[model samples]
Target: MNIRKRYLTLILIVAIALGAVGTYVGLSVFAEDTSLNNSGFANSDPDLIAELADQQENIEENMGKMSKVVDAFSIIQENYVEEVEDTQLIEGAIQGMLGSLEDPYSVYMDQETMKQFNEQIESSFEGIGAEVSMKEGNVTIVAPIKDSPAEEAGLKPNDQILSVDGESVEGLDLYEAVNKIRGEKGSTVVLEVNRPGVEDPLEVEITRDSIPLETVYADTKEKNGKLIGVIELTSFSENTANDFEKELSQLEEQGIEGLVIDVRGNPGGLLPEVEQILKNFIPKDTPYIQIEDPSGKKTRYFSKIEKAKGYPIVTLINEGSASASEILSAALNEALDYEIVGETSFGKGTVQQTVSMGDGSTIKITRFKWLTPDGNSIHEVGVKPTIEQKMPDYYYTNPVQVEEPLTLDQSDSKIENVQIMLEGLGYEPGRTDGYFNEATKSAVEAFQQDQETEVTGKVDEKTAELLQTAIIEKVQEGEDDLQLEKAVETLTK
Candidate 1:
């Protein structure tokens, strides 16, 4: 698409996407603009006027095709056992239309839900601070925001939420599940999560709080006598691009010889933000990303930067890196030949835009599929790293659920997790094969002693909590960040 056409398309989408109040304010301002003609519309944009006209015609034709639907609504209103609200019927019809698309990403949100969504766009909300999506009829976590309650509670990407508190979320939509997950700050919500590779479900209690909107974090690591700048993106929020540029400039001023762009646990946000960040590194010779519309028409977007960075750069990603994160990783790897070091990312290649129904309600529809720089769509298949690296075994271990003290000879998965945690904490448990033998007891006793707890020589509730806490602290210390080390090595070598 040409620049003007693309601008018009974006305007149309935004005009439709804004909430009812926003739309009214926007149109009121537009109508009062001095540039408007006698008809109270901008005559300067003839092309936009034509596009609007065409859209009106399409809407009219589609409305004509919906006569049968109207008839059905009338029949249901008149012949049903009980009277149905017109608002309910109307909302149902809208939902039915979106549901027919059979896409989990396309969903209908009522007025209340739309308000919460707008709050999210404005940044800051009371929730667990995690991105989630519908996958295989389950509400699965995309990734927890950095330092958020979800992350603190150890929620991982692809962790399927089975229940909220004690209620099952089996038939609820993504927004509904999210509503259940969100609450007033300081309120605790128990999530029953089914993590991959874990035989049993885990009950994680998370206290809701105001989720922070800070997206970019910058630091430096010295390897091989070279200072390697590390910029980790937690998400691509509204100010992420500006923050990234400032951080990058500071890093460059520090005379860093290498850089590692980490998007390990980033469940993506605003595409334009990632695009702006990519412009700093991706040369002008290639397109940074491509958007393919439903009609199979693709629009390639390129950065204006004429040259790549002088220093070597590497991208760090993992299963939690998704959407815009995948875009950045794929573009850097495919366009600039940068090494991607980590596990495959969370595949989310579609682009969604919300459209208001003009009544505070909204429908978020998947309008396009985003392709990588090489015209490859990583939809269900995530962006694979050039150098695949998995974290330590304890990083993937599940939380130990202690019903009773896990004594010697216990062969539960919880015991196995404890063993892994014990091993990761440097107290070798002899084996991680789920069997709690004599050596495992010794390992438990050692850990309890180190923790200055009662040395029971058996895994108990207090012992399990201590073990999980130690593992979290170790992971947070970044000492065992194998993927980051590999990334630094790649950049330095």
Candidate 2:
């Protein structure tokens, strides 16, 4: 009788607290009596019974809406023709929930994916060793790790992994594709690669191995009687800061005049690692990156440094450079006198935090949007270089220039093709005729000038190929990259 009174007193206290805020209070009535259902709550304390009834009504309301889903699940389990596992159903439901957000970065990872995720952060994993992302709904290779099987197999930037080991990856998620690609050491995985400008898919067979993450590749070169330090950072991983510091020490000891920090195909990693690296270049207590939460609460991360390196810096970025790379590049460009060369960065300014469920599963969710030190948001609108430079074809193996130049008044089938292409590109090449006239020469000269080529009236092989490649790909074309040359010139000056 004393125990019952104490339980009723505790229930009354909880009910009073909940009623103060007009919230329903729940009470387990039949926890001690297995035979008594929730319907038997009428026999309990009156005021406590009222609070319990309110909670029961709320539960029924929620469950009423879920009845359709329960019914469908039951029907699938019992009446469906093929057998379906409960695990698959639960995982599919979770995947659907995340997919409803329409975010490529937000995803649910299973046990295998969770394992690989941890392995990547630890800086060692058995796989082809490439960073991939879901771009335009396809598993696209951002870049291959240096000295890894993927790099050794000649996997270039922007290669699409279409299939793995004869299994199609048409609708596979990024993590799912990664699982398919990763295998035990010494095993081989055949990947069907779709490379730009290639007619058919190329079959690339790569032998997987334990790939150690070595993010920074450093070297020095003598140009214009000054030693220039060239540091190629692949990603900002766990040991990147230490590796970079060692390389920087080596270069500084040699008295390098300038530094060229290349992050051309870097897909980015660990924000804190990047912050640690940035502190070496930027001053102490300077605002490096700002992050905004969902409620618009902003937090600024500052550099923790004693002294700054006083060398002229140049950061090289391309379409593959993303996330941490963007932050570092933007900070250097905004806070220092460094020049950002190459194409615009791969803008992924939103930050994601992974939460583990303690059951070998995890969910990666977007939690914040990061801003540059200048308070500029670089999410979809990537960081544009001060000097705009386009990357040339990385896989151009043929001879660049043709044997003979196509001149004015020359009647050839190729002339007609060029005229058609020029007209299509809004160059006003007069007509798609076999004869190249003065109008054709003027159009060719205009095209060459726009392409940053010599303004020659005749269509040389370089000019012709550039025009054709640009027309087909709708991008810049050049055998010699003027951007790197410009960077070397800037360093010398």
Candidate 3:
């Protein structure tokens, strides 16, 4: 069989989870003109034709050496104790080949998985609305979409999924695990997640819902007597750039003096969407980004804008910011000398492109590495903020899971988390240590009284639920957002 005939078209670089609404940290590049025709080389360029001939000769030579694989397949199919399907054999062989590459980003998608992926691109689907990626042999959450069920359930970035609905996902690939997570609308999927710094695995129940395509949110803030425009980007979807432009125009019309571009929990999406957004800020004098091919060739991309924005701009990022988020933050910081405030971003600097196998299946392969305008690759090393600022300690505390009432003298990690939450809520929990002291009891009693619950100085199921609800409400209110305050302060100063 001619190997070249198997590959039909090249798709995007971003890996979209069949279960999730948007893609994780990576740019999407669609290579339509690079498809090969029957005669090879749709463009009919002489150099491409020569390259194709050379590649075909190499493939023929490799095919001769692949006789051992053919023999193994024949043996498995004909000499096995039980009958095996030909499709299974073929797919297993393909998966084995990809596994040999040892790159988790490069993966095979069966026909059903590919169909689901295509459907997600055209319209929203029912799922737990989060972007996940395989990290170190585990399916890890990159970021939950803003206003998503996952976010609402308190799922945070880097949470490793150990099982789905009581079934272990130990050996399943990213897409397989996603298949288990995806379901119809209003169906609850229980996820067993292993979070960092927590000794026990927590069970998270999320009701799947139809994820919307609204990726950009706009608002304004009055800080230090100056009207500051705030535009929060959840992901760089197909229409994100257009929506951002419209919101930005509206903010400008409101006579804002400073601007804050917030991408704290954005996972990332379409490459062109971010590139177009960058064009509005980055000047033509400097390159916004660089793409390095496998052969060490680098291509620099620059914006056409001649001047920068009239007002000072500050970018907000955190550990959940990745891919196109990193691209935008790095460009604004390195190319335009803007200030970046918050924690370091999630590092993801490689690019992937999907190749169709002509049988409704596809393979996404890592093809290139992306670099910042300063020629820095933030792959394992994420982009550092110019002014680093972390959220309150309670913000990183795990959810309070109480099987029994945690009373006085109880020493556990759950108690420590409760102490942190109590302290953050303005109650004086004398010690943040695991050992629950009298001060903690008093603080809990005070909290219970304030919340109109029973004055039991213990953390029961009701108290835990109420505590988590109160904290979530506080966070959503954005009243204690120190990072945003710092960004506004920087602009005002």
Candidate 4:
């Protein structure tokens, strides 16, 4: 990613999803390229135009900056430094932009990548089945796909790739890293990995093999002193709707009552599959998603959201739940009024469509913004769980100190609030001691120093703002689902 700054990853995917083809049409004040019909799809069919309009409006509502992306892309296309293949340039632009955002969920997929992705969703692909990715500028393992070649290679999550076949891939593009790692079945791919708690990256190798994908797995568990039915979905793959039907039958066979769907750490798969999955729980003929363009023109995509038999439902999500996950959650939240538990979902609510060019290359463009049936845009601001879950330290990487000590120690209530929050997290403060003594002051001071706030040891408004660091933590501590749980507990009534 030759990124100047980390912009939103959704934006990059979105821009492509909208119109990755033709040319880079930068936004201009007037019709600068009058010959090209800057009106953009003005002559397209009514139905397509309607879809585009809805997408535009949804883009505005959720992520505000997309309005300018077209303009920038158009301008860059017209006047880039060097002449590059139109498709390559566009793909490069998307990859570069998404790379800068540093959001792992936001990504750009060229034709090959897109095909691999679609294949993964359909649950049938021939290759090593490891969920590989880049982290901290190095190719790292997210998870070895269940029984894929990468898993067989003994790869684990968080294993960083150092080299491929002894060729250093230290500073390589994501696709470049993937290109090196993926190959014909039975071909050997060697990788050097840096594992967690390990001082340095190490080397391991794997012989690629055919990878098969599956969807819709079910099991039973006991929660809240009741035997609850649990459905774990690895992806929204093709045939999911049929697979879902089979699961419904199984649930009926078991006479399951309550439902707990675990979509933790799931990266999106197929849209049709997600739509069907959601339809199983959502209301029939209800618009699962509504999109809008800049002009407020709306297009609603209906979900087959019909409640299956009778079941009290709860959907679980986490940081890795994205794209298709968002779609499924939106459908359930809109249709079933189900409660969600776990962390804030990875916000990837934009629609991506791939257009194949005459050549082997293709373009993935951001076409529309996806919204919940209630008209809530889940783009930048993701779907917040009704039951927010506080994860153990193993789950998240804390970038900012929840509370900085009083930066301007002498400022307002900043230091005091931080002390209070620390106590809230169960970290002992210098007593419930309200005073900003050495201990209280130290916590406040460290936060303040880290944040580059003034080091005055006083609790002020800035400290209060800083104390808000614990807000997510507080919410995650199971504050979102109190009412729902109460309702479910008394269902026997």
Candidate 5:
């Protein structure tokens, strides 16, 4: 893989599940000819020169407004209650300027922040290596980088970070929460995580290391005597093309009859990397991706290679899949006639240009809009899969309410159900009695530890759900595996 590909990895890396609305942050390198050091501004364009002149005239006209701001700053510096650092004032001014745009995507990164931002796009970093976002007003894990410390620590997608090292992160900003998790190499950070399906906060201790961003995963599964190859792409990283080629060769040697390419939580990476990946499956003349500039001029990107051997291919995607992931599925569906399964994607159609300043600061601004090969704009409207099937709901249907934390020595009829469920799950919650006793507390603690929830020995909403779901799964084993069954059937058929 080329070093230039590493620079492109910064694209489409910002992905967070907002409350009802999810925002996918994507990196966009507008033109192949555009260099990272260059701003890609066409200085030779007469129209752009005219626009620049007009902008300068406007700045002269707005000189009075700038004077007022400068006057206010002088007044503050001269007569302020406390001495303020010049750097603080300057960075704060920059933040205020960008914040006034009302665009959450536009942010001002300081030296340290910019360093971390650039490191995030690199092949490796010293951290837990999990992509996080502010979802539902909480810090949530978008996806753990493959083979990274986060994945090794069992950090999963949609897992909410309740606290970091005993400090609650309820209202912490996304970047601040990320900073808290990042630390020196070999250092340890304990996180309190609240998972979606599980009812209870889990305590996860992770030792920070040099996290490697390995993207491709391949496996072979035999279903109904048919050999099926599964390639799971976590993200499009710098070495994704190389990793993919090796995986594809291995799968080919395995004599697989069909292939399933899963990009469920792929937050997307470099556009060129995805284009190269598509080349393996698409023909040379096929339109892989389309880019539309601000003036409505359209440009089509094509694959350089012909389609590989005829093999039934099925691609899996979900709402977590954004930008380049959507591009891959759209290209495969458009060119090779492959079927896409799973839910709708994270519809992020806009491309972002990462501008690096001379002072080591950076600003990522939205630049252009992207489209599928057939000229379908995916901005805010994600790619709809051919087979739109939501993952089966395994959450607890039975509501278990607890106004207060139930502890030992408290008498409540609710304790009986907890005891019965624990015993059924083989936790030995002691004697199915209505009274909450020490034996039951011990059982609850044991159950909570096993389920990786906070060992409060009390039934909270999370704990109760875990208990109910456990019992339900125990009662209904070998059932409700619809999505897996569908994938197997599709591959075997």
Candidate 6:
């Protein structure tokens, strides 16, 4: 009786608190939950609020709807075609919900899923351990977990995971794909890989094993007569925080000079991981990012740990540099004055939070927009490199160029730049060279015609200036490029 009474009291308290918060925010209890249907305010009086709730209103309607779903599930479970475990049904329902969200990062984890997730963060997981990532709407492998089953089976980065055990991975997200790949130790997980520069989708069977994930790869080398440490961070996994610290200590031991932090294809894993990494560069008490809720309540992520003691650092970014990569780069560039080099970063500043919906389903929503230390938005506005360094010549092997009539090729820097511009404006360009190449000239002619210029098969200084202006306009359009987006918490107490 005591326990039952306590549970009811707790429920009543929770209900009261939720109602109070909803009222405070002026969320209309009388209106539909849809953004377009909201009335912006709620009616006063507890009785009125209770009456509105009792009328199967808003959230109550949702609860009632959910109750119907569970009741249906219960009925189905009692009279199904075959005997089914409740847990399996629940897991399937959860997976379906996550799939509906279309968010690869968000997942509803059962005990097994939670165990696997924890292993992925801890830098160890069973089965064919491949670092699953999304590229061009396909769940791809960034790289096989180093020395894991996938790596041993020759799974490389940029390998598209087409199918797992004959099941197409087309609609499966990273989590679902991961769940499919993971199995009992010594079990075989067949992955159909669509590798670039390969004619066929190669099938590779890997025996399950505990794969170790090394997030931070650091090496010391003498480049240009300067002792430089190149650190390649694959992802911001939980283990990366410790790995980064170890590397920092090693750099200190080696008498740190110049550091090249490589975050080329790192899809951000954990927010806290990036926060900890930033602590090495960001000053104590320094702002990192601001998370804003739906009701416009803002919370700041500050640099809590003392800044990591270091030297001249240069962060190398590329199109693949995203989430945590962008976060770290923005923090270093804006707060530490560290040089940012290489290509523009992937602009992903929205923070996502996942909630379990009691009915075995989950909800993952964009919860906040992040700002850098200087309170700059870092979403569409990617951190611009301090020094623009084109990809090295050696890295270009048969690099395609834009086909322009009466022009050289993509090797020409101007044509290459023009191609980059076209790519930015949702056009395809073969190469990014500065030559008056065939591809370049054709692209340039079209671009000029669009701008009411004479259709000349050439890229003159005027066209170049126009391209620059277009790039600038894109940056200024609230794309969140504050170097990094950390908030100042304006007037919030």
Task: Name the top TM-score candidate.
Answer: 1
lDDT of 5 by residue, 1-493 (tens): 2232232222112110110011111112233232232433443344544654565455444544455455555567778999987567756665677656654446666568878877776577898988776555678776677667776665666778999999998755566678899998899999998876556567777899997677888988788898888888988878888899899889999898988888877878777688788878777787878898879999988766765566788888876787788988887887777888887887767676655544566666666778888889886678898887765432122234577777778776566667767776777666777688788888989989999988998888789877766765553453554544566578787
- The C-alpha stretches of model 4 lying farther than 4 A from their native spots are 1-118, 131-144, 149-163, 166-172, 184-207, 222-227, 284-286, 292-298, 304-309, 377-384, 388-493
Worst 10 residues of 4 by lDDT: 393-402
Which numbered prediction scores highest in lDDT against the true structure? 1
Per-candidate TM vs. native? 0.91, 0.68, 0.89, 0.55, 0.68, 0.57
**Alpha-carbon lDDT of model 4:** 0.60
| Tens digits of lDDT, candidate 4, 375-490 | 88777567788867654431222112223334322423323444556565554457443355677666656656766877665556565455444544453343444433433443
Q: Write the per-residue lDDT of candidate 3 for residues 305-340, one digit (tens) a residue.
A: 899999989999998999899999998999989999
Better structure of 3 and 6 per lDDT: 3
Residue 242, model 6: Cα distance from true site in angstroms = 3.9
Itemize residue pairs with steric clashes in candidate 5. 11-27, 12-26, 12-27, 14-25, 199-462, 199-463, 200-462
**Overall lDDT per candidate, in order of appearance:** 0.85, 0.75, 0.83, 0.60, 0.71, 0.62
Q: Report the C-alpha lDDT of model 2 over 286-389, residue by residue, as the tens digit.
A: 67889999899998877677656777888888877889989888999888858999888878898987655445677788889999988899887787887777
For model 5, the stretches where C-alpha displacement exceeds 4 angstroms are: 1-72, 134-138, 147-156, 159-163, 166-173, 190-207, 306-309, 377-382, 388-485
TM-score for predicted model 6 compared with the true structure: 0.57
Q: What tens-digit string does per-residue lDDT give for candidate 1 at 165-204? A: 9999998888989999999999999999999988889999
Stretches off by above 4 angstroms in model 3 are 1-54, 119-122, 449-454
Model 6, span 203-256: residue lDDT tens: 667799866667887887663455666677877887788889899779878875
